[model samples]
Target: MLSQSELLQFSRHIILPEIDIQGQEAIKSSHVLIIGLGGLGSPAAMYLAAAGVGEMTVVDNDLVETSNLQRQIIHQTNTVGKSKTESARAAIESLSPYTKVNTISEKASREVLGQFNSSNLTLALDCTDNFESRFLINEWSVANQIPLVSATAVAFSGQLAVFNRKQEDACYHCLYSNMDLPEGDCTDQGILSPVVGTMGSLQATEALKLILELEQPNGSFLLKYESLKTTFQKFKVPKDPNCSVCS
Candidate 1:
């Protein structure tokens, strides 16, 4: 039930024909687990919180570094030495007090995920920079039948895709054959500040769309964005039965 204050707070969202009170209520009830708090996770977390997700479990093992401030918007200069989870929690609280945030200062692993992986988990967002973490997150999402909104931003390129086990959609592993990725992450190759931010905002939009049950005519597709070219190309990802993770 939305309070009088919440009703006024989300009036713009409620007024939308697609996301009326029912959709807003669904957003309020959804619990999303976000892994990684770097460039992509930063905007995704803030947008989701402002959009009114009932609960968010933030997982990140790294500490906020001075270098991260350029891309990781959730962490500030005062929090440079603090844990990413704590910094993110503090930031989200300042923006949306009603939304509950659970901070996990641990690496993305089955042990950490087991504690929060439950019936209430609406979805999992892969904001990780490396392929290893993304694959692990995908495996967990597939095993638990949870939808995964995965995004990657490196250099001037970004990719966004939604994977659902219940929908028999292609899992994240299906997109990659070799787990070994050379020159992986923004650390190796440089990434533009807004390029990653743009992807993160889009990632949040996809999560809300899933919660609202928006129409996706493109059954199972991956969106690739090249900032330099200012072009977006969509490709279909077919599930591979031989894939180790989902199979």
Candidate 2:
């Protein structure tokens, strides 16, 4: 049950027909795992906390660097050199003290992810930058039948996708099977600040929809953003029948 203070804090959310009191309650009961604390994770974590997700476990071994301030908005100038997980946790707590924030100041190793199965995790958000981390998170999500919302942004381009392990959803490996493909990084490719912000915000949006059981993106569709052209495109991502992870 929402307290009087919580009701007032989330009055806007409770007013929505799709996200009434019941939905707000679900949001307050859900546990979301956020893997990464870089450009994408920053906004995603902030918004999820702001939306009242009851428990959030953020995983990241990296530290805030001065270069990250341009896009990693969750960390401040004073937080540079501090662990990203700590910095992000502080930011989330500042936004919503009611939301419980847990920090894992380490890489999302298989052992770390193995501990969070579907029984405990409500959803997993892949905000990591590299393909390896994305693949590992996808594998864990598929194995445990947990819904996964993944997003990436680099070089003015961003991509967002939702993989519903409960349904006939396409897993990440279905779309990118070739692990050898070059992975883009902000340091090398130069990403626009708002591009990641847009993607991260969308990731949080999809997560809320999933938690609320609202109209969510079909698992087979991929949303791509091109900042240069200011265009958003949606394409069907067919499931690979032989996908090792989801098959």
RMSD of each: 1.5, 1.3
The residue-by-residue lDDT of candidate 2 on 48-78, one tens digit each, is 9999999999999999999999999999999
**Model 2 scores what on Cα lDDT?**
0.91
Task: Score every model by TM-score.
Answer: 0.95, 0.97
Off by over 4 Å in 1: 178-182
Q: Give the range of the ten consecutive residues with the poorest summed lDDT in model 1.
A: 176-185
Task: lDDT for model 1, please.
Answer: 0.88
Name the candidate that leads on TM-score: 2
- Which pairs, if any, clash in model 1? none
Residue 137 miss distance in model 2 (angstroms) = 1.0
